[model samples]
Target: MKLYQPGDTSRAICPHCGKLVSTTFAYRDVPFEDGSGVVKGILAAVCDECQNVIAIPAQSTPAIRRARDAAEISLEVSIPAPEVEILDAAAYRVDPSATTRFRKSLFAFYLQRLRHSEETAEMLRRDFEAWNAVKTEQRKRVSRGIRIPHRRLSFKISPKTDRDVQWLMETSGMNKTDTVRSVVMEIEKDLLGPNTPRELRHLQDIAAVVNA
Candidate 1:
């Protein structure tokens, strides 16, 4: 998508020269038909007076659309976890139920927020703990495994249209062609559904072919 915030000017004092500089930055989505099938864009910022080019973040621009879309569909709410009681070995042995009680208290507090009581809290806590443990184990499994390396390659594009790739890149904060290619690649992947793994393998093969 093209991103242009025309007439959006912010006054800021530059830390380097201590001069008030008017910053005009454009975000463009650049396309990448290379390996990884990743969407990459360029967020180029130029100092109006100094003519100094500052890249806002190539990764940021490239990743922004995907991240924003992900955020929109995500149900990842950040609620603080309940505080746990840390006791010495001797104390813990003396009061074995202390830890469980602390957990119980936390559940109670959480239940109260949900308009539930201690009775409901105890059941919810057990269920939550079970789910939490499963997630933790999955995390451990993923982390403990060594990751496989992927290949990277570069390729050229055909630009026979009047569509100004530079203009699209600067205004939309995306690589015009690369962004389009990336989006098409993603859509193709999504359409693959249950055969995503196979599709990904095919992608790797295609990447190799592109390089060859």
Candidate 2:
């Protein structure tokens, strides 16, 4: 691979100009594709015409990845043992060798996907209402019967994901705890299904890197 340096010139297709154009390598602050965050002062190929960072060198990949990891925030929640197990089961089903880390990745993936649909708020409300009913019955059982166990699950997530969860809360009328559980409920139904989804390939790919 060629190592780029400041003032180095090359010919590359610039998306902004919509054609092949001259580019000059320089260190610049580049935003991630999703616009969630920016990686500062990374070496990139800037289009001569539009002044946009057109192509990044292979060597800058690690620095960009580090910026992403640094921006992560921990997402933690406490839920019943069964719900946690369901999440882990989904992870294992995605990749037989996946560990607990993959479980968090799986749920994070589901949470991110849920925010894309307009109907997610309604679905989450239904799931949470059903869980509320179950909890009410469980309390009655606990009065005369056995105790239920709970566990704490935690993982690192991006700020955008945190924002999405908050948005879901506002739309669905569920608190953070119930919101996460409702996500897990959806994860269980999709991941533990009889037929593997086409998106399973993407999930498996994530699991591979996550559990690596």
Name the best candidate (by TM-score). 2
Global lDDT for candidate 1? 0.37
For 1-212, candidate 1 gives per-residue lDDT tens digits of: 44546334555555555677887765444333322232334454556777554334444553755643332311111221211111112123323333332322222222223222444334433444464476457656875875433222112222211123233334334343332322222232233335534333443343344334
Off by over 4 Å in 2: 116-120, 135-149, 189-212
Clashing pairs for model 2 are none
Question: Backbone clashes in each candidate structure, one number apiece?
Answer: 17, 0
**How well does model 2 score by local distance difference test?**
0.85
Worst 10 residues of 2 by lDDT: 139-148
If scored against the real structure, what TM-score would every candidate get?
Answer: 0.19, 0.78
